[model samples]
Target: MENKNKIYIDAIKKIAGSSKLLKDEPMSRHTTFKAGGTADIYIEAENEETVKKTVDFCRLNNIDYYITGNGSNLLVSDDGFRGLILSTAALKDTLEVNGEYLTCSAGYTLAVAANKAAENGLGGMEFASGIPGSVGGAVFMNAGAYGSEIENILQSVRLLEADGTIRTADACELELSYRSSNIGALSRVILRADFKLKKGDKALISEKMAELNLKRRTKQPLDYPSAGSTFKRPDGYFAGALIEKAGLKGFSIGGAQVSEKHCGFVINKGNATSSDIFNLIKHIQKTVLINSGVELTPEIRLVGKF
Candidate 1:
């Protein structure tokens, strides 16, 4: 580590303690893809205050930092990141229900939140039951499955702004669209989110959740390590169908292969490297664009230098 980096690391240890700090932690262990090199520093923040303090410290010192939650939709490079990765995964995972609204911390898993909503006879969260991500990440990307999306139920969120201040903002202010949000552009961190749901039959809600999860298990490549849906659904064209029609399903580049079970996902076949996955994604994009008129765009977030 450089002298300046070490100095910041030592300073951050003082703010968040040595237990919260990890040096040269492997990115493969954090990401769902289970591929990539190590990170210089990884901080598992324990609460909102710790997150704020660390962000403030990094800003003041001009240290590069990236916030992560669950690492479900991330693909780190082989060279790894040279900066700090501040994760909300260790924060207090709490869910509270107040009438029609369900409030949860950023660290809370979407599956758990969906189940909790079903338990309380609240509907609308069933569509998110199978998404393998945290509330913060899901909200950040407007994650959706089986037609319903986070924007439909999201009411408000408590955010840590770029200026190191916390405030609640309405869902409309987020400009939640298809797999996009304004949160990252504004340099804001999601502390917590309030979801507005409707009262429904408890049995029906549970049944809907179970049905969606069943469909996911049958259609998605859940057995292998993948970052779920590799490409975004192009306008008027399904990415999976386009790839399949191009005869690229079950194709392999190194250990990275287009999943036979779901052509949309690029899966790591045991010993795949980050480079393999990256190359496979590009190949898929080029092939799909050549075969069909629609160009495919990656849905997963790339980290570090790829």
Candidate 2:
């Protein structure tokens, strides 16, 4: 709570309501991992305009800020973020549908979007029915499941650049690859996205989503707090298979443990800190490399201090 920080926070509060501004907000309360410390200043901008105003103000003032969506795939440090964290949750309040196409705000969850598409009798997004992340994060990482990724259905994305400009990038321009996208490297704020879909029976689409949801529930370690799959599926080799081969199943470092139910996930057995997970991940990588000669890359993004 420096004088300069208070001044900057006061400026940010004017862009939105006072209730939207939080100081020393607990990071554990925001992320899916249910761990970490706090954010020095957290801004919950209600709409794109507020997000733009807040970001522009920060940029102009030379104040550090990080934009995030959903916080599902992030590991925040125990020391917490020293800068402003602009969350996109408040920006998700709109969903528009036209025939076989759907457009929604970036903060909207993929699961909600998939359900909306199903309600409109739209297909091609059944794989997103169980993803627990926002549209912005999903598109950024080219997230996927069940042999399908967002690139298959994504038409374009409305990205807000750092210089206060908005640009629409097509899927081709994003260079969507296995659990990656070019936009992720650019550090732009995702505003919205258009999804190309197909006309299908609502009942059939619901059935498909239901089947996938069941598969996810049965296989994933839903009982514990985790960032979904901990490692990306390496080319020609599954990360989970390699970890299992390396004998790291149910391996524990502090309270963080490689899930016995599924080796792909690293779960908090309650009270696991950020450092615990980091050590566990490194140990798994080293063991898997020695035993299987394959390196496991983390699917989750690390933020703030370690």
Candidate 3:
């Protein structure tokens, strides 16, 4: 334990600049669910250089590490992570619009990117108006809504490979599918992305975004703490519908409950632990499987201990 702390501290010092490093930072504050344990080493990298240095240090020291965007779709275990957590939330840079294309950093929020597109009179990102995640995370998951998806607009992505080298790839190489991309399964870290949009009237774009935002507000239980949809949509079926039909809506396990407002979401009512949410998810999965013969797969990424 002493040797581990020493190694972590040495790595932190080797990284350049004011990259903040914390030992055992609480995961609850980082995730949308507001439920998780602690991460052994948490580093907030503010720029590409710092991120590269941090990644290099971790690799050289043979440290276990994982990068996270906004943590909107993540569930960390109550027992906590035993390795480094790299947060790219500070890499918030955007280039000036060039024709119908917009270049943005990975750390930029989807809402921010959507608003930027709207501001520049660019259309096609209206579907992401209310997505509570960073640009990198959205692209990694091929995030979609309201009949539009990242695959429709993403042209290219800048990624940092597992060996600490940066590379660029076209959209075709990403292999995007329903809420997933090849990057999600690979070891590459997203640095930036280029999106292609249509030159549309600003008024029309704003109107469409407003309309979608209103729809999201009306349909989703935004008041509660959740990691959005709890389960992935099964082939030819919706996970929420199955859970609802299984009579699990409003079901509670500790402070975690299947949201009555939207059965697809398992929300933290208040003071919910990671264990509570995990148990609720398992229960819902079991019930849905028994009732409908459909195994519900999770959309939310689960990390840390069981």
Candidate 4:
């Protein structure tokens, strides 16, 4: 523990500015599930400069680190994370719209961006009105809904490479496909994104947003704590349909349960542990694979020591 503290202290000093860093920060507070242990080091980069500096410092020290966007689609384990957790939540910025184009920082939430677009009479992002993730995370996963996706409006993206250099890549280079992107494989950090929208009546856009939001409320289990959809959509079958068919709705393991409202979600029923969620997920997978030949993949990202 002493050695770990010393390493974290050294890394902190190497970074410039008045950046805030926390030691032994509880992961539970940083995740949507509200369950997990502690992180050895937690750093919140308030600006792009701080983000670059911190990344450089970690690289130089051979420190293991990862960036977390809104923590909406993540699950941290019980044993906790020993490395640094970099948060981009403070890097929030949205530029003025020029005609049909808008540039936004990675920290801005998708819902915020959609609202901004609607306010500006832009007509492309109404489908993202209910997405609960940051712009960077949405772009990283190519998040989509209601027959629309980030790839449809995305023009370009600014990214920080592993060696601390920033570069811009065109949308076509991202290779986005149904909740997956090249960013998932590369060790790069998304900084900002450029989106091209269409001109539309503000009232019409607002109506579309309201309709989609209402549909989300009706179909999703929003009353409980969950990391959105629990599993990825299988080839020809929906994960929720399979779970419901298996008679696993309302099934409980510890404090975790399959949401009765939406079988696609595994909710944290007040006091669920990461182990409970993990076990429940495994059981669901096994059952689904046996009952249906299609294997359900996880859309939620899990990290930390098990």
Residue-level lDDT of model 2, residues 1-306, one tens digit each, is 233456676777888664388889988888988888888888877788888888888777777788778888989888888878888876776798988889989988998899999999999999998999999889888999998999999998887886788888777888888888877567678889999999999999999999999999999999999999999999899898899989989999999999999999999998999899889999999999999999889999988877
lDDT of 3 by residue, 15-93 (tens): 8367777888998989999989898888777778888877887788777778889999999999878788888777876
Candidate 2, residue 140: lDDT: 86
TM-score of each: 0.97, 0.96, 0.96, 0.96
Model 2 C-alpha RMSD to native: 1.4
Q: Of 1 and 2, which scores higher on TM-score?
A: 1
Model 3 TM-score on a 0 to 1 scale: 0.96
What global local distance difference test value does model 2 have? 0.88
Instruction: List candidate 1 segments past 4 Å from native.
Output: 1-5
Question: Considering every candidate listed, which one attains the maximal TM-score?
Answer: 1
> In candidate 4, what are the lDDT values of residues 17-111, reduced to their tens digit?
56668888888888888888888888777778888888887787777787888888888988878777888766775555889998889988888
State the lDDT at 191 in candidate 3.
87
Model 3 residue 148 distance off true place after TM-score fit, in angstroms:
1.1
Q: How far out, in Å, is residue 142 in model 1?
A: 0.3
Task: Tell me the spans in candidate 3 whose CA falls farther than 4 Å from its real position.
Answer: 1-3
lDDT of 3 at 124: 98
What number of clashing residue pairs does each candidate have, in the order they appear?
Answer: 0, 0, 0, 0
lDDT of each: 0.90, 0.88, 0.88, 0.86
